[model samples]
Target: MKTMTELMESNIKKNYVFSFLMNFRLSNGLWMIYMASRGMSLTQIGFLEGIFHVTSLMMEVPTGSVADLFGRKLSRSIGRCLSLVSILVLIGATSFFHFTIFMVLAALSYNLESGSGEALVYDSLKYLKAENNFISVLGRQEAIFQVSSVVALLIGGFLGTYSYHYAFWASSGIIAFSVVYSLSFTEPPILESVGRNSKTFRGFLKQIVDSFSLIARDRKVAFLIFFVQTILAFSACIFFYIQNYWKGLGRTEFQIGIYLAAGSFLAGLVAMKVQRLSHLLKEKKVLIILPLISVASMWGVALCSNKLPFFMVVAMIEAMLFVAGNDYINKLIPSRSRATIISFASMMYSLVMIIFFPIFGRIADTISFGVAFVSLAVMASCLYVLSMYLLKKIG
Candidate 1:
């Protein structure tokens, strides 16, 4: 086994670039959601988030094909550049229309990134004869990414307390650094064989079709994708409801930031240990347990009236299970079409969210936050059972 230090030295530049981009992107995650909520009505916030999902859904296949054809490195660079531009727009924007434009731009950038970066990293590892270690490497990368998220959340929250645009401005600067890093990235030679034919628009479409067809042909992949969609939908509801939940607890945006940071920090720590955990627990078993734990955590969120204990438990659950679940999903995916498959899976997830977020938000707005959360928990619990059964039958 490669020591962590050895892995870092061998892939220093690539890993650093990935870390920078993740830091830039995730640092603003909580802040952006907070801003959208503060700037607009809950309904509008839902709409904006839905738009982000819709844009990603629309772009998923095309962008996946772009990574497939043009090479993941090139596609990732373009995505990072677009992300930087989006952050800049968010910094300058004030009006609802302007915010919408920024949201759309940001969504575009995220859609471009959905799978390209991981594909590039996987391809690079293959070149280095470390393909067999992809799961552990990916887990490590996720840990780094989550650490960046924790840092970014802390900083962004502080800035957001002053002004949301302050957070946006800081995010823009981070994205600029990410863009620079991405531009310097070199594609691994293994990708060259896959890039034999010069790519055309028509070829890109065909590749998209082929990727989707391949996914459909594999029962395991199809079931996993649907399972991922269900899990993400529940996850989305919890995250989306957090702002409102914190408000009920009389927490300031800064305090909420602290809570978000705590969760992410824990997630980072757990992500680092995922490979070891996977060795002890089968991936399918982990998947089932993770979502169940997530459901229980959300139920705890629904029940808690206090702040510190609420946040602590939430962070613990997220770190121990949620991050581990994500790492397992990454491990299950095949290297050759990892990005495209991930993108396709994400697109389906977004499609589900695009429909569900609005309804869930409206329910939170009209009925009760607790009601929406509990409903999600119940649905997630059911999905966990279903996923376990499916995986068992398939295996």
Candidate 2:
């Protein structure tokens, strides 16, 4: 049998493989275009995205608590299973209702993995006495995500032009494999001590209450969650809707895939360099500047004829924050309820996406994608100012 340290090292490697396999979402780059081809408008697609986030907002915390109480490995494996189911549903989807079903399942799948996976990796590192190296590991993980995304998007885009069904089917196969791969992950031993003591119903409720109470006491944690997640929501909006904008410009699916893959490649490079960049820039300064950069990217994408540069920059910034911001937030919380609190952060992101994504879609449907992006930029700027004001007031 391997020692604890050896076990942890194995967990880290398995996690990287799991994350890579999970992100092979070939359907992502073509979902909107496929729905459009199926006679759904952008507004309808946006509404579907809203449904996803609404489900995530509702289930994120509970799923995170499940990971905290039961086991992170279990949570991750179940998530992959649900994702596989969602993809299967998506392939057969025709009407709005069918799409909504798949979206809800996908959101539930995300809720399970969102916090559990990160917390699992962090705890594994802690066991190895390398918790401090989490950001570096997370950076590499994000880089792997980008690399897989580039490959998946390229293939998906080419296949989707022939038949969206092919892309969905390809994604389903990858997710099915991930479901099995995720099961090979071992639960960190730290969880035995960190999980709630009593296995009763009340213990579950207290675990949740205590997690929320921690957030209530730590204003900085609360602020960090809100600030980082809100920015993430805006960045994700740009990433998805930009496909529509490119399609309107008469770009082929393959060409658009290449464009998105380039952005992902650059983002991967930035993710890999996050540790060095954070050392040079200071994490505090990076956090402060990130929102500003996101705002500029949104505006540039909205107004400029050449939008690729802005898109790539936004992708890079998003990847950087995933590494740095999570490291900062995770340090402020305990392992016992770490997944739950992180889920709260994701819930905040979903809440923002739920409110804004549909509205942005409607605006695009009514006017133009450019105008919708301009609105996003304006909203992001106002939110940034508000977050700063709140930070100062709280400080």
Candidate 3:
């Protein structure tokens, strides 16, 4: 048997590689600019994003189930390959229709990774009887990759200064490497694999159905799922508009890069401590308190004109949302359908994004980014009340 040290060492190595590979997204930092450069307007961009999230929502469960049935390693490899191809297409894409196709494929790639990656890491930890470390490990890996993406974000911007193709080509090469690495990852033996047969298909459907039933029936899990979706949607709207929000306030074009880079660093720095925070505060408190941070952050964004308050609040709230939500939800599901359950969570956020993106985009265009920012804060505040009430009653 592998000793605990050996198991941990191996797992950490694999996890590190997995973490960096998962963040191999170069186009992320500049997608808005790239599409804008292609002559797409704000409405068109929002519509394309809506389409991407809708596609991701549709695919999340099936792909998560695919990972559970086949292997997360394979699922992850497929995601990276798809992302690589999507970036390649994006590089060659010159028209609105081409960009729409790119969004479809990119969204598919995101769904493939969303749940499978988390499930893979959690299961790997569980197999080694190191479940207690899952939160810590997850937090650390997110921290690492968030920092890596920070670097990629900067590089992507620099490349975009020359040509958007430079950014896309660089992104594609990174994703190709990630695909190779994911293909090499060994699946944990604890996962039950499905084979080609009607019987296996029936069993797969049953498992998915059971997972859905459990989430629906369990009030707390259901609340957590939806709460995460809403909070993330709030973040998504605020985040996507922050660059312009700052520019509207008379900040330099140079400061925008700093804000983006700072946000990533602060996100990583805060996320690294999520495990410790979760252990210290417990889930109930986390559920109750995280939203207060979101509320405060949103208010800060709406009210504060200075850079530090805005950026710091944005960073902290985002870090808290991701880490706390995952810490709670990961412990609530069975490993047999863990990926699918998480995908359901991902789907919630996608659904929220699909519904809200255009509305917020229009609001930002018609009224002001500040008004839209405050509006999302109010929505988040309402969600917070619901979260506290539900958790208080059942938790």
Q: Is candidate 1 or candidate 3 better by TM-score?
A: 3
Give the candidate order by descending lDDT: 2, 3, 1
Q: Could you tell me every candidate's TM-score relative to the true structure?
A: 0.88, 0.97, 0.92
| Model 2 misplaced regions, further than 4 Å | 191-197, 393-395
| Candidate 3: pairs in clash | none
Q: In model 1, what is the error at residue 235, expressed in angstroms? A: 1.9
Query: Which ranges in model 3 have alpha carbons more than 4 Å from their true place?
Result: 1-9, 191-199, 246-255
Candidate 3 lDDT by residue in tens digits, 101-173: 8999999988988888888778877777777787788778878877887877777766766776787788888
List the global CA lDDT of all models. 0.68, 0.90, 0.77
lDDT preference between candidates 1 and 3, better one: 3
Candidate 2 on 1-395: residue-level lDDT in tens?
88878888999998888878989899989988888888889999999999999999999998889988888999998999999999899899889999999999999999999999999999999888888999999999999999999998899999988988988898998998898888888888754354446347787788788889999999989988999999989999999999988999999998899989998888899898888878898866777787788788888998999999999999989988878889889888888898999999999999999999999999999998879989999999899889878867766
Please report the candidate that would top lDDT against the real structure: 2
Cα-based lDDT at residue 232, candidate 2: 89
Error of 2 at 144 (Å): 0.5
The TM-score, computed over Cα atoms with residue i paired to residue i, of candidate 1 is 0.88
Using TM-score as the measure, the top candidate is 2
lDDT, candidate 3, equals: 0.77
